[model samples]
Target: MTLQFSGWLPGGPTRPTTARRCELAGGEGAVVRYDERADSLDFAPDTGPHPHGLAVVTARDGHWCLTNLHAEDTYFVENMESGGEFVKVAPRRRDIPIPFELARLILPVPRGAGMVKVFGPEPHYLAPSALSGSAANWPRLDEDCMYFRVLVALCEPQLRGCPPGAVPTVAEVIERLGDGRPAYRISRAAVNHHIDYLAMHKLRVGEWAGAADGKRSYWKREAVVAMALRSGLVGEQHLRMLPSRRVTARQGPGPSRLPAPPPRSRR
Candidate 1:
């Protein structure tokens, strides 16, 4: 599992221009300080010492905790996956559990406000028997199908620890699903068809979100991604299906493993 943090350093008058990122494995801890003498990630000025400092964060298998080391400011961890849900870590609080699978750590800084993008690990699944018989009536998706490949491609950016706003376009989805296979080809129409099939037939997003065809392509992509990620339909494990060249070409590191999906079972 991985825990990544992104912070902004002072750069200009209006907004912080420089960004500093740090990564830690499970069981690792680091101090987010802002001074010339500070260690780990230092969001100090381009020159001398700055009083802006004091925050500690630790990582675990699936979640992380933040300690507000500053004596005055209370830190806020906003759950980016959810709609504006946030939790506050009181001043001097230690190891407050953060429940967001994807989050933003907000800090009051010399600039108007400093933000850190926090990426948590994929969620853990409950025991198979816990809800074994209850899923019979639910909409079913086959991971080995071509349509499923399109869904995974659409959600790749977020699944690979990028922001949720990075939903791929239809052309992008076609490129991702191409993967250089023999005689494998997908067109824009084919991709849109797959997405439409997913939104209306498989997931039944129309009941509340209305028809997918009426909305713009951007809205349809976002709706599909939101529903898929929220329901744990596509995740980090499925990212292997994406081509490695394109996968690592993304901002952060891709998953360490890229094994092909198990051979599709004969129906």
Candidate 2:
């Protein structure tokens, strides 16, 4: 469909000024509004998770429309000028939530030359700098950043035999995870819920050194360490991933690295 852009500015022509019009060739020519201030193109309100979403890209060649079928990762690329639709998409990556991913793609695209748009799920109105913050960029991709880090924090200390079996309950885990560092405001119930989920799957979270008298869930003092070690989610290299506050004050900036052995005299 032919998209006509008209605008009237200060000291402009008397007749209706026709800005460059772009042809929309894809799925359906969705009636869309671009909120420049908000930097979002949305078709509906934040009602809930729905299928209808649209994103726009502009280029010297013309405008292109993007559409998606929630059933799968495949999206249709519409050639606005020819009204031809072709599907071109990599498999929907697990790391990318289709809706939030729009920001990652939108920003890097070279402006004044070409544009590409994407739509799906709830609307995310983000600016070019959305990548600056941790949450926006997802520093921890697939893993549950909350508990996973707490578990990783325990690794060095527990391996070194420093105050073994410290945190026994969800509340205690929360305390140690917070202690002095900024924390993810997680609750006991949430921890318990996730513990139950892990247990239901019979996932081994490494060997727990703490006594298992009567706790219903498998999340013991060393459960996080066990999980990290066994699943290879967190390693010694990831010690820096731990929060500063989680590190015991006595431990300095963080846990100490095991000192290397003396070199052989013959060498």
Candidate 3:
């Protein structure tokens, strides 16, 4: 796996958004440095290294780590793909393991922030059975089931070509599934059950049994959505399972209502 780092560099114009990878002759990974002299100057030139002076970053085993060398300021590493999830590294912290596949390291400058973007290798999973006959190593799911409909609702925003962001909450999922169809009206408990079924039974995402109840719900949904999209378990074509967005009058109705299109013409 390779690592790429992009931000401020010495003797060149700063490009905060452009990305470049480390290409050293030897197999030894590159040790990139951020010092107040150059990197911080891009954000705050006059302040004398109060919050950020130096940091060292390196990659190992498909993950990245950072060492904060300042005396009193704390630094933040954010998971850019997850919705506002971040970890804090205190002053003089050494080799803080960063678990994000894509991360943004934020150093507090005087009036602004110095940012370094880290792009790690994309995550890898075992190929499906058709490719390598490894069916036992992968999760098996039935796409025709109702649980899949719940997942499609969670992924609707992303499948519709919207920006990558938060998955729908339980209430939102219920609303999307209901869509003026009384037969599909689901209770909050049932929705939670379906999400847990996907995460625990089918996906085996992580150790959710020990996490706090409040945090478990949030992380479980995020993990399932991320894994589903990454593993090709769900896609835009499955959106047909959800109720149609069109509003048409029922056969003998006085009010317009949203309903699932006929199965023959759903596409």
Q: Write the per-residue lDDT of candidate 1 for residues 1-267, one digit (tens) a residue.
A: 233335453442353334466666777766666433322244322232324556766777778888786788888887765432468899989889888888878766554455677777666889877866644655678998988899989888776655557888887787667766536669888888888898888987766666445756477777788888777777677878776763434478768787888998899
Alpha carbon deviation, residue 15, candidate 1 (Å): 16
- The predicted structure with the larger lDDT, 1 or 3, is 1
Worst 10 residues of 3 by lDDT: 41-50
Clashes of each: 0, 7, 0
User: What is the model-wide C-alpha lDDT for candidate 1?
Assistant: 0.69
Residue 84 accuracy (lDDT) in model 1 = 25
What's the C-alpha lDDT at position 141 in model 2?
27
lDDT of 3 by residue, 14-57 (tens): 44544444432212334433443443322212122324345656
Give TM-scores for every candidate, taking all chains together and pairing residue i with residue i: 0.54, 0.28, 0.44
The per-residue C-alpha lDDT of model 2 at residue 185 equals: 54
Positional deviation of residue 66's Cα in model 3 after best superposition, in angstroms: 2.3
The local distance difference test score of model 3 is 0.66
The order by descending TM-score is: 1, 3, 2
Which structure among the candidates has the greatest lDDT? 1
